[model samples]
Target: MSAFEVTQPEIHTRPIAQTELWELVMEAADYRCHCTGGLCGSQHSKTGLRCPAVHDQTHRKGKGLVRLVAAPADLGLSDLAAVELPVDQLQAWCPSCYTAARNRAREADANARRIADGPEGTLF
Candidate 1:
């Protein structure tokens, strides 16, 4: 019998001050929308949709949100405030890229599993 193994994704770590954290998120985005990569794609604010806007991260219409895994919980933001907020070092992405990356990751995991299992030998 073959043993089954589970694989976990890698974890990234970083630190930032509360206010500095917002600055980092905004800086990475360059005041542009992650989805359309625009300075004012439909999500633009009256001030032209500033980057690093915490609300943008949670808009959920397939724009501006950048999810981070295993993030630290000491940024001093309320749960709602943290929901859409990106990490200081994390870059924003459109929904398409996010989905594609996830798919590629799944395929890579499958390929790794096949290689680990190896091929059976055939003899006449």
Candidate 2:
């Protein structure tokens, strides 16, 4: 992934120290995309393409690609001060991977809505 510099915390919900958290995440991921087995990552090269894009802490709603969002872990924590999560919970995904993931989620949502709406009927 591209080199990312967190000059300031992006969280605006509450006042919490995110610089350290961001650093920890970056260090844990070795400043690289956490994508594995070529599932989703940079498509720049034929082999071992490491995207140089800013990473995001992506979260998927379900296994069916319902929704994917990027935000600080404290978003769900009632007590923002006690925001702590495992590296796995907050994976570092490159821009490409993140986009792909979001697209998949969008597609899934659209498909679900279409199915729910069912076939359109002609008006007499």
Candidate 3:
């Protein structure tokens, strides 16, 4: 193997909803991304191409797209059972918006941790 070959990290799997939950969430969002009307606007890419992605979970499944997911705290619940979430909380996001949201959350968490840890080589 070449020294430049990079190993991909293992994928973390999450419990996803069955068809019924997927349908409910999609309906609540009117079959479009919740971000569609906000400043994010139109669910279109910077190149002006409309994002063709449907409402989907933030995770992947064995090379397939995951359509919906219950809250992370409820992932251990049965997929066949209905997940009850507040109408305001059950948002449908296109892949681009979803990815941007996840990345922002990740960065926020990292920043919080760094702040809590204090700067390197500094002491109170």
Candidate 4:
């Protein structure tokens, strides 16, 4: 194996551009979530859930929690670049999509590990 034993990536503080963050949030929301669509408090009262985008997914058998990892280090706090606006809003993802993403990541990591281990056959 290579000297780097597939350790988790170090937590680097990367500065996020406000425009980029906004785009990410909007893209995740599709301008349809409670945070963007102006339906925050009421929707949850009726059904104990937030975000219309996710609500719609619930009918289709989805967990509906936002998969957007804008500020994981912030402990469930959305990243806010300015006092007035969140840098990245939450997202809506189906459980299957989330699982697929996770599986893809795992496969990629396994491929990386195999590469690190080098050729299977002995050269000498």
Best by TM-score: 3
Winner on lDDT between 2 and 4 is 2
Off by over 4 Å in 1: 1-23, 31-89, 120-124
Candidate of highest lDDT? 3
In candidate 1, clashing pairs total 1
TM-score of every prediction relative to native: 0.32, 0.41, 0.44, 0.31
lDDT per residue for candidate 3 within 40-123, as digits (tens), equals 334345434433444443332244564433232222233343255544445565555555655555566778888898967777
Per-residue C-alpha lDDT of model 1 across residues 21-124, encoded as one tens digit per residue? 64455456653334322322334444344333332355445555544322222223334665665584244443343344445555667787887787767431
What is the Cα-based TM-score of model 4?
0.31
Instruction: Rank the candidate models, highest lDDT first.
Output: 3, 2, 1, 4
lDDT score, candidate 1: 0.44
Tens digits of per-residue lDDT, candidate 4, 60-103, equal: 33454333323221222323532344554334333343344445
Local lDDT at 85 for model 4: 44
Full candidate order by TM-score, most accurate first: 3, 2, 1, 4
Higher-scoring candidate on TM-score, 1 or 4: 1
Model 2 lDDT, full chain set: 0.47
RMSD of each: 20.3, 12.7, 15.5, 20.8
lDDT of 2 by residue, 1-124 (tens): 4478546666322114555555566666655555444334235364356543433333232223112223232222333432456544565555456556546555667788877788668442
**Residue 76, model 2, lDDT:** 29
